[model samples]
Target: MTARTFQATNPATGQPLSPAFPVTTPQELASIVAAASEAARGFAASAPQLRADFLNAAAAGIEARAGELIAAAMGETGLPEARLRGEVGRTANQLRLFARVAAEGSWVDARIDHGDPSRKPLPKPDVRSLRVPLGPVAVFGASNFPLAFSVAGGDTASALAAGCPVVVKAHPAHPATSRLAAEAIQEAAAQVGLPAGVFGIIYEDGYELGVQLAQHPDIHAVGFTGSRTGGLALVAAAQARDVPIPVYAEMSSVNPSVFTQAALEAKAAALADGLAVSISGSGGQLCTQPGLLFVPVGQVGDEFLQQVAARLDATPACTLLTGGILKAYQQGAAGHLAKAGIQALTQGAATQIGAQPQLLGVPLAQFTAELADEVFGPISVAVRYEDLTEVTPVLAGLEGQLTATLHATDDELDGLSDLLHAMGTRAGRVVLNGFPTGVEVGHAMVHGGPFPATSDGGSSTSVGSRAIERFTRLRAYQDFPDRALPPELQDANPHGLWRLMDGERTR
Candidate 1:
C-alpha cells in the first residue's frame, strides 16, 4: 500500500508548515493493527528490562531533539517557545519515568499463591496471577498537549511499556510535531531490535477514522485525551462493538480553586498575579487550568478583585492555537457577559487571533446561576460568598474535575478538613496553595476524575507506574504446566523482580 501525507499549517502565521497527508484507510488501519498485534505477541515476550532500555533510548532521542520539536510545536500550535520547551521536557521526563517503571517489573502485580505444602487439610493448588498486554492499543492524540499527550505522549509510552503495540491517531493540530516524534520512536524501536509495527501513526483529518479505529476488532483498548463530547462519542462507539473494549477517555474539566479568607487576606496581590499567569498560561488550553475562583466576601474579596483586575489588564493577548479556538473563546466569553446580572470586572483588549485574559465578577448567586460552568479559554469567573459556610454547596454543585485547589492558611485548612475531603471526592487532585497547571509525573498524582472530567473515575492512568495498567489486563496461569508460563513470570525468577507469593509481597 502507498503512504499518504497531510499538510500542517501554522495557526499564527497562516503558512503551510508541512504537506497534507491522506487519511489512513480502514484497510490500511486493519493491516497496521494486524502487524501491531503480531508484534505485540513477541514484544510482550521480551524481558521487561529490554523494553525499558528502548523506552529510555526514546526519551534520550526526544531530549536530544527537544529544541527542534519545541520550535515546530510552537509554530504549529501557536504556543510560546518557552511553554513548548517546558512541555518537551515534561514529555521526555514522562518517558523516562515510564522506562524506570517498566524496569522495576513489579508494576505487573505478579502474584504466586504457592500450595499450602504443609497444611493440615489437602494441599491447596498453586495459583499465580500476572498482568499481560491487552493487545494492540489505539490512542487518540490531543490538540492542546502536542507533546505530553501527543504521538509519543503518556498514553503511547504507557501502552508500549505495558507490552501493548500502540497506534496513535495524530491530532491534526500539530501533525508535523507528531510525525517528528513518531520518527524518533520508530528509530528507538529499530535500535532496540523491536518489531517495526510495535508503534504506528495514522494521520486523519476528522473523527471518522478515529471512530473506526476504536471500533476495530483487533484493537483491544483505547486511550483518549480530549473534549467531553469527543471522548463520550468514542466510548459509545466502543460499547457498540460486538466484543466491547475498555476506553480510557479523559475528557475536559473546569478545575476550581477556593481561596479562604485568611489566605486571601495574607497574599491577595501575589495570588492574583499567580492566577493570572495560570489562567493565561498556554492561553488557558490546559485541562488542569483553574477556570473558577471562589473568594470570600468583604474586604479581602474586594482586595483580591482589585489585584486580579490589574493583573488581567497587564497580561498581553497572545495568539491562540487556532482561529476556531479564538472564536470559541470569544463566543463563550460573550455568552457569559450577555447573561443576566453578570458583570465584567475587567476586560482585556482583544487581539486578531488571540484574546487577552478577561476577569468577570458577579454576585455569588448570580455568578453561580450564569457563569459557574467552563468556558475553555483564558477567562476566569470570580464568585464571592459571604463566608466559609457558603463555599461547600457551591463546590458540590460543580461537575467532576481533574483538579481542585485551595488557597488557605493552616488554621483555615484545619477548620475546613471536612470540606476539603468533600472537595477531594469531587476532584482527582485536591491541591493547597498551588495552582493546578503543572501536573507532576509522580506516584501520588491523580489526573482523572468523574463524569465530564474523565469517563473512568475508579482508575485513572494519570501518574506513576499505574498509567500502564490501563493498557494491560490481568491473566492468571491457573494450574497450568510450567511451559505455559511466560518467562517474566516463571518460577526461576528470570527477571529478578518482586512478586506476590501466597498473598504476601516478595522479591
Candidate 2:
C-alpha cells in the first residue's frame, strides 16, 4: 500500500524544502518492526568485526555528505551553521566510537566457573555466562538533535553495536535530514554485507505511529528523547504490552545551578557569564541547560542577578526549532510573569516563529512553587535565598534532573558537604564551578537521572560507551563442553578480554 506523504518546512522562513517524505501507517510500521526483528537474529550471529565494519562505514557515509547534512539540519532547525556542523561531527564520531566499542569484545561482561568436584559440598556444575543482544530496538528521533539523536544517533549506534537491528521513527520536523541519515545507514549496511532489514526508518507526523511501533510485538526495547509528556506516553504504551519491554526515554530536566556566598563574592560576574550562555544557547533546547539559578541573598545575590540580567538583555532573539516550540516558550514566559512573586529581569518579544531571551527572578520563599515548571527556550529563572537553610527545601522540591551545577569558592568548599549530598540524590551528573551544557561523550558521563529526567537509570544511559549495555542481557550456559561454550567464556580467553573466572578477575 502506498503511504501518504508530507513536506518538510523550514522553521526560519516557514517555507517547504523537502524531497517529500512518506508517513507510514500502523500496519506498514508493524511490518518494518517485524523485518527488524528477523534481521536482528542474523546480525547478532554475524562476527563482531562485521558489525564494526558497518558502523565505521556508516560514519564514513555521513562524513562524505557532511555539507548536505549540515545544510538540511540548519533549515529544519533554527540552529546556526557552526552548531549544526558540530552536531554532524558529533553524530559521525559517535558512530565511530560505537564501532570501537563493538570491536573491544569485553562489554559482554563474561564470567565463568568450573565444576568444583574437590570441595566438601556437592560438586557444582560448570557455569559460563555472557551478555547478548536483546533484539530489535525502536528508536524515536529527537526534535532538537536531528543527527545525533535521530537516525544513526546514539540509540541506533549503541543498538547496532550490540548487534541488534533498528527501526527508527524519524522526527517529522526534519524529514530531509532524517532521510539523508537513513540513506547513510542503508548504504553502509549494504556495503558491509548486512541483511536487507538490518535498518529501517519509519516517518510519521503524529502519535499513532510511535505508539504502534512501541507496542509492536517484535520490538524488544525502545529509545526516546523528548518532552516529559511524550516520553511518559511512550513509557505507558510499552508497559501496556502483555510482555512489557523496557523503554529508555531521556525526558525532561530543569537542570539547577547553585552559587555559594563565597563564590558569589569573588566570581559573580564570571559565573553570571557562564550561566547566561548555558541557559540561552541553542534557544535552551539542550536538555542539560541550567534552567534554575540559586543565588545566596544579599548584596552578592543582587549583584549577580544584575550581571546576569545584563547578559540576558544583550542576547539577541533567535529562531526556535518550530512554531510549536515557540508557542510553548511564549506560554512559559507568560506563565512566569503572571506569577505573584516571579520578576522578569530581562524580557524579549515573541514573533510568529521566533523567541527572545527571558530571564526571571523568583524569590527564595516562593521559588519552590513558582519555578517547578520547565521553560524550554532562551530563559532561566534566578532564585534568591535569604538563609542557607532554605536551600535544602528548594532542592528537595525538584524532580529528577539530568544535571545540577555549582559554581563555588574555596572558602565555601568545606561547608558544601550537605549540599553535595543533597544534589547527589537528585541529579545524575554534578558539576562544580562549571556549566552543564558541554557533555563529554566518554567513559564516565551520566546523561540521565531519576524519573522525569529519564525513565530508567539502573539499566542504561543515553550517552557514552556504557549505553551499549542497554540493548543486551546476560545468558548463562551451564555444563557445556569447552568448544560448545561461547568463545569469550572459554577457558583459553581467546578474546583477550577481562573476565571474572573462578571468583577472580583475569584475562
Candidate 3:
C-alpha cells in the first residue's frame, strides 16, 4: 500500500508548498526505532567530546544554510523574516550551548563517597554516582517554534548531548523547515562518524505516529511541546508502555500579567502599549503569551483599558500560522464574549484570512474559570479586581503556568510579598515589570511549570543546560573496583570533573 503524503501550506496565501513528505509506515517506524536502539549503545558509550563536536558541527551546518532555512520557514509559518531569522539564530546558539555543557563533563553531577575502612567498628563501602543516558528518545516537533523546538531543537540537542539517540516526528505545519534542520544534523552525525540512527526524523500529520513512537519499547524517553491534549496523549501512550518511560512534555500556560495600582498611575499608556504588543505579537501564538491581564478596578483602570483598546484597534490583523488557528481564534473570541459579564473591549476589524487581535474584560465577580482558558491567538482577558488581595484567590484557583508577570513600582513591590509568593507557587517563572513573550534561553530560565504547564511534574525544563538531565538517569556504583567505575566517577577522576567527594565538593 502506498503511504499518504502531506505538504506544507503558506498560511498567508492558503497555497500549498512544493515537495510533499510521505508519512512513515509502521515498517519504517519500526526500522527507525530498531536502528536507534542499536545506535544507542555506541552513541552513549562515546566520549562527551565526540558529542560536543557533533553538536558544534550541526550548528555550523544550520548556519551555512541559514538563508534556505529562513525562506522555507517564512512561507510555511507566515512569520516575519526578522523573527524567523532570530529563531534560526536562537536554534543554532541553543545547540552550541548544549555542546559546551556536554564538553564540560561536569553537568552529569559526579558524586563519590569514599570508603571508610575504620569508622566506629564498621566499614563504609565506597559509592560513586553520575548521570547516564536513558537510551533512545522520541521528540515531537512543535508548531509555534518550527526551528528552535522542532527537528534539531532543544529536545534533540539535549537528548543527543546526553548520548541518547533521537527519532523526531516532524511537525506537519513546517515539514520543509524540519527537513532542512534534519539534514544539518544528519550531515553533522556523518561528519562526526556517528551511527545513522543517532538522529532521524519522520513526517506525519496525525497523532497515531507520535503515539506509536512514544510506545516503542526501545524509546526510553519522550520530549514534546504542544497543546495540552497533545502532550497528555503522549504521556498516556508512554505510561501504557510495558516499561513506561518519562515524557518531558511542555504543554500549556496562560501566563498571567498583573498591574498594580501604582504601576497604572505611573505608566498606564506604556503598560497598555507593551501588553498590546505582547498579546498580538506573532498572532499571540507563543505558549508564554499573557492570556490574562489583571488590573485595578477604578476609573484609572478603565482609562488604561481604553488606551489598550485603542492601541489594539489601530494594530492590523496578523496572519496566523495556520488557517485552522485563525478559525479557532475567531470562534474562541466570539465564545468568550458570549458569556455574561464578558464584554469585548477591542476587537480589530475582521479579516477573511488573518486573526484580528481582541481584548476582553470581565469583573472579578463574574470571572469564571472557563474564561481563563487560553484562546491560543492574539487575545487576552482583562480581569478587574478591587484590590491586589482580591485577585490572589483567582490566581490560586488557576492551573500551573509558565510565567506570572507583575508591573509595579519598587514601593508597591515591597508590600507584595504575599502576592509574589502566590504567583511563584502557580508559575515556573515570575517576571517583574516585563512581559512574558520574550523568553530568554539561559541557564537560569525555567520554561516548565507544575501540572498542565508541563507533564514531567514540573521537575524538569525543556530549555537551558539542565534540559539534558531530562534524557538522563542517575546510576550509582557501590563497592566497585576503581577500573569498573565510569571515567567521571573513577577514583582518579580521569574526566577532571568536579565531584561531590565524601562530604565536600572537589575536583
Candidate 4:
C-alpha cells in the first residue's frame, strides 16, 4: 500500500499550503533509527569543538534563510510577522548558545581523584568521571513554537551539543516550516563533514509515528514540548521499552500570578493593561501565559477587574495555530464559562476567523477543582480573595507550574512571605512584579516543573545551557591509563576544561 501524505494549511484563510509531505512508514522509521544508531558511535566519539563547529554552522545557515523561514512560519502558525521574526532569531541564537556550551567543553562536569599509595592502610585507586552522550535522541516538534522549540529548536541544539544524533517528528501544524529548518541543519551537517544521520526530520499527522519513535530501542532519550496527554504518552512508551530511556517532556502549566492589595492600589491600571497583553498575545498559545490570576477582594480589586475587562473588550480576536487548536480552545473556554458563579468579565465577539479574548471572574469561595485546569487560549480567570490565607488551599490543590508571579510591595512582602514561599515550592520559577509570558533564554532559565509541567518532575529543563544534560549520562573510569581517559577527564587536562580534581575545582 502507498504511504499517506499531508499538507500544511494557512490558519488565517484555512487554505492548504503546497508540498504534501509523505507520512513516515514503519520501514522508513526503522531505516532512520538504524542510521542514527550507526551515526551515534562516531558522533559521540567526536571532539566537542567539532560538534560546536557544526552547531555554529547550523545557526549561520538559519540566519541566511531567515526571510523564507519566517514567511513559511507566519502562514502556517497564524502568528504576526514580528513574532515569527523574533522566533526565528531566538532559534538561531539558541543554536549559537549551545555551540558556546559545547566549545567550552566544561559543561560535562568532569571529576578526577588521584590515587594515594602511601596512605594510612590501603591504596586508593585513581578514578575519573565525566558526562557522555546517550546516543540517538527522538525529538517531537512543538505546535506552538515553529522554530525556537521546533525542528531546529532548543531540543535538537542541546542534543547535538551533547554529541547525540537526533530524529525529529515534525509537528503536523507546520510541516513546511519544519522542512525548511531541517534542511538548514542537514546542510550544516554536510558542511561540517558530519554523518547523514546526525540530524533527521519526518512528517506524520497523528501520534502513532511519534509513539513508535519513542519506543525504538536505538533511541536513548526523548525530548518533547506539548500537551500533558502527549508528554505522558511518550513517557509511557519509553518506560514500556525493553530498555527504558529518559523522556524529557515539558508538558503543561497554568502559571498563576497573585496580586497584593498594595500592588492593586498603586498601579492597577498598568498591571491590568500589561496582563491583558500577556494573556492575549500570540493568540494565548504560549506555554507561560498567566492562565490564573488572584487578586485581593476590595474596592480596589473590583475597580481593577473593571479596568481589565475594558482592556480585554477592546482586544481583537486572532487566528489560532490550527483548526484543532481553535476547537480545543473554544471547548475549554466554554467549559470555564459554564461553571456556577463564573461570570464573564469581558468577552470579544465570536468570529469564524479566530478565537476571541475572554476574561472570567469568580470569588475564591466559589473556586472549583475544574478552575485549576489550563484553558490554553486568549482566556484568564480572576479570583477574588479576602485574605492571602484564603488562597492557600487553592494553591495546595494546584499541580506544579512553570512559573508563579507575585505583584506586591516591600511592606506587603513580609506579610506574604509564606505565600511567596509556597508559590516558589510549587513552581519552577518565581517572578516578582512581572509577567511570565516572555521567557528569556539563558543559563539560569528553568523551563520545566514538577509532575504535569514536565514528565521528569522538575529534574530537567527543555531550554538553556543545562538542557544538554538531559541527553547525557555520567560515566567513570577507574585505574585506567591517562591515554585511555577522555580529554575532559585526563590528568593533563588536554581540553583545558575546568574539573573537580581531588575534590577541588581546577583546570
Ten contiguous residues with the weakest lDDT in model 3: 347-356
All candidates: CA RMSD (Å): 2.0, 1.5, 1.2, 1.2
Higher lDDT: candidate 1 or 3? 3
Query: What does the lDDT read for residue 219 in candidate 3?
Result: 92
Spell out the clash pairs found in candidate 3: none
Model 4 stretches with alpha carbons more than 4 Å out: none
For model 4, residues 78-155, the per-residue Cα lDDT tens digits are 999999889888999999999999999888999998988787688899988999999999999999999999999999
Lowest lDDT sum, 10 consecutive residues, model 1, at 457-466
- Among all windows of 10 consecutive residues in model 4, the one with the lowest summed lDDT is 347-356
Q: Estimate each model's TM-score.
A: 0.95, 0.97, 0.98, 0.98
TM-score of 3: 0.98
Computed on alpha carbons, the lDDT of every model, listed in order, comes to 0.83, 0.86, 0.90, 0.90
Candidate 2: RMSD to truth = 1.5
Tens digit of lDDT per residue, candidate 3, span 1-507?
677998889999999998888999888999999999999988988998999999999999999889999999999999999898898899999999999988988889998898888877789989889999999999999989999999989999999999999999999899999999999999999998998999888889888888999998999999999888888988889999889999999987889988988999999989988998998898789999999999999999999999988888888889888887788778878888899899889957447788778889999999998888888888899999998898887898899998999999998777888888889999999999999998888888889998889997689888889999999999999999988778898878776788898879898
Which residue runs does candidate 1 get wrong by more than 4 Å? Answer: 1-6, 117-123
What lDDT is reached at residue 337 by model 4?
88
Which runs in model 2 stand beyond 4 Å of their true positions?
A: 457-459
